[model samples]
Target: MTVDRLGYLGFDASDVDAWSRYANNTLGMMTAAKGKDSDRYRLDSRAWRLAVHRGEADDISYAGFEAADAAAFNSTAERLRQMGYQVTNEPDDLKADRGVIDLVSVIDPSGVRIEVYYGATELFEVPFVSPVGVSSFVTGEQGFGHIVLATPDLEKSMEFYVAGLGMELSDIIDWDLGPGGKHKLHFFNCNRRHHSLALLPAPAPKHIHHFMIESASLDDVGRAIDRMERDSRILLTFGRHTNDHMYSFYGITPSGFAVEFGCGPRDVDRSWSVVRYDSISMWGHKFISPE
Candidate 1:
């Protein structure tokens, strides 16, 4: 699958009001629309980049990867069928809301939901309103953002993402929580924005850790942290990661899940040689939640 970029992501949240507030106040994203089933936020000129839906639980609902073209979209659907995964095309209203020609949905071996789509509609006439005065996110050039999910079947998930979906392994970190504590986490980068997806040491049918959006500068990252603290939403350490060099901190979303606000991620060069490291963090972030 020649996945060029991230299409959009779906989140299941109970408190839509909180989500809307956090998104506008902390994340600096504009609300495109809200409905009975879901709410959409726009990152740029495109219709929407993130969708929040009412669900029984708070977790990542689905991930949408943008295909290079309609051909790729059709091919991905066929490939999913060959792999014995169910696929579905977006309904008419959904297509209009998403601004996509079509969306092909599938569930991986770990039962993670994913969608592949093409032809994103955009309105060049509309000016982008940066919520919270956030200058910009590292999106247009790096894709939308990255997602980290927990999965038990690491090898199988790896095969599906790397071999099947065409993501490259950027780095792998073996984590030791404490004495006799060890865990293996791998990072995969689809575009230049470091790892667009990461897998944690867990079993199948796991919850999402958090998703990241790029900040224009380190100052923005610090500002977000300050805002989160002032607003009583701070969730974790304000530190930098060694892997992608993303200076970030974690905060509680309105949906009751963690959100990573980051900036200045190390962009990868396709021609360069691989540089592997035993650790992913140099300093700052000393906290890791198992929830």
Candidate 2:
């Protein structure tokens, strides 16, 4: 019942070559091709944090949440079944692909695949080395970073993630100027990371809205923006979020979804009281992509 962190993410994209270039040249992720089609990218010591599998749909394939251990995995599976969700034991072949010891799988209200597991394979043989001259990534107990998912029905999604999954609510943003939009943002945290997952209004492409990766240095973000200008599509202009206080800019990936390269976000804890804000960002984060 205790979901620990936002573990690895598996995404399916048609163009693995494009993803490889963007990950290595721009984001500075340690990259390796998986099999003949898929490619895995590493931001930390973990075998892989993000997997872009070659597929027809350019969308998030599944999200893995780290459970405490074998006991936790069994407890979580039972908990989900008691809640009326179909929790299935992950097959061995899939486990090998995910690099996890054990896990249970379930589909959320929005039909997104969710896995709860422990023992992600950590690579001690080859340490993470960013080819783009960047320093270390902001990971560890926080996991890779936050991922935002779009759902048509917010209440159902909340019931699955918050009530069923038991992820801690970090904050909510009902930002409206006056006649402000009806869209609502719900941020959830597992460990110290401000939000491991966010449930947002589903506009279109009802998959992952974006996933974030934070840099230890602000200069790295600036450098990425410079690199993004030449090769990638810009989604959100440079901005700071009012809730997490993450200074970041959003760039469209080769798969056509956005990734927030951020820095210096405030950490959260049990004492962290959930608050509501009226704005998405404190300074920037303007919508740059075509609507």
Candidate 3:
């Protein structure tokens, strides 16, 4: 069985304090008290969508993919084993820590940890209130947005995510960098959200290039641009993507990787057709310095 959507993300951050301010003030996420050494932020009804643990890596530690139920979770774990990949069933204490009923992990070809499970803890009674007054985040069925990973072997990564994990190919983008050569980006979808994961063939210092979070309103995005500009964290100027048509901007996280904040991306449907694009964005998205 294919996974549901992008559930949650964990980051090993060097400075937890920086992440706290960034998540609260810059991204407008609600902070939850996880512990003194770690920080957890809520995006919707879910107990937490993103977690930051104190560490030196300052990159994505693990990505959690949700299964609709126990059956789906079991089927996915079995499918991974059949594809010649080792799957680990995590212990009870770890499951408690993650606030999930069950959890199994597998490492992708790019060496990023992938956690698959079901039964996430929801805090609906508590209600989500964005510190920076973001109206809401587009989560629920679409999951907790998407993640783009940089891998050395695109084919191998595609095989693992597509053939093994059951993610369908959404579209492709072959970007030409003049003398630097060409780079092909493959986007995959598990649900209606245009894409929940993407793969880029390149060498990078970190496992992840960026993770995207969608806002419910365009006004929220406009206000975020102001905050990023004040902090000089804008990594890529405002732009609309060519493939998914996401109107978003990239900003430097406390860690070195980028975070794409946007709204109003077209959803994938049964009538969707796979196509390739020559460029990454339709308009805007100019690379900018974070000075």
Candidate 4:
């Protein structure tokens, strides 16, 4: 499981219109193309870094990780089957949506659909237009930011991501859930972006708590919140997080999902520090309630 980077993510949206508005108007991403069932948003004008598809439920569709080459993609698929998990050649829609030469799909122990692929289709002609008339997102260099998903089996999910996918642990947060004696939330990083994915214990099988995108600066994050609240009447947190050190907040997407608009995420060199686990959140987040 030698994943090169976190390639892209898919969302199952019950309301594509809401996501369209949220992605285009609030997040400052460019909508490169759209169709009746799905729409693609450009984080760095490489076709799309995020795809939202019309569906019956609003949830995370899948997490796609990049393999170094076509051989690596096939090898991963064979390894997954050897481990007693079912793997598939990339679905028709997935292949078309990602514009990849080859891909393999498997469900993790926690039931999250994971896609491993090589050679993503890119667009040179598509120019990124900031929805807020600003500059651009800090992707391409950092790749996209992190996505947090809820899992019932926290420890096993951690093993799958850290050992199976080759992501390194950044830190772990133990939430004081009253009588529960502090449940666990783990963060893992691949590229420089803080925590490409996180695990949260919840009753659900495997669903995203929220997915984040890195903005240019703190001011860009603030402007996004202001516009979302004033014009769209959508409300959420406006505070900085302790873990990532991102001055950010969460708002509901049109798909009835949460999106974290943030900037200034703490990056790592990987070689310098030993993996650290901490108890306290970097800053107090009063907006998002603990469940």
Question: What TM-score fits each model?
Answer: 0.91, 0.94, 0.97, 0.88
Q: Name the TM-score of candidate 1.
A: 0.91
Over 1-291, each residue of candidate 3 has an lDDT whose tens digit, in order, gives 679899999999998999988999999999985944468999999999999999999899999999999988998899899989999999998898899999999999999999998999999899999999999999999999999999999888998988777899999999775575788889999999999999989777899999999999999999999998876479889999999999999999999899999999999988999999999999999988534
Q: By summed lDDT, which 10 consecutive residues of candidate 3 come out lowest?
A: 31-40
lDDT of 1 at 115: 81
The candidate that achieves the highest lDDT relative to the unseen native structure: 3
> Per-residue error at 185 for model 4, in Å?
0.5
RMSD (Cα, Å) of model 3: 1.2
**Which sections of candidate 3 miss by over 4 Å?**
35-37
- In model 1, the Cα lDDT at residue 109 comes to 62
The lDDT values for all models are 0.76, 0.86, 0.92, 0.74
Clashing residue pairs for model 2: none
Query: Residues 1-291, candidate 4, lDDT per residue (tens digit)?
Result: 467577788888878887777788877778877634578888886777888898876888888888778776776667667667778886777577678888788898777799888888778776777777646687774566778888878777877776667778877777665565666677788777777888878664338878888878777877887877854544346666666678777777776667777787677674536344454346534454433
Of the candidates shown, which would achieve the greatest TM-score relative to the real structure?
Answer: 3
**In angstroms, how far off is 139's CA in candidate 4?**
1.7
Best of the two (1, 2) by TM-score: 2
lDDT at 65 for candidate 4? 86
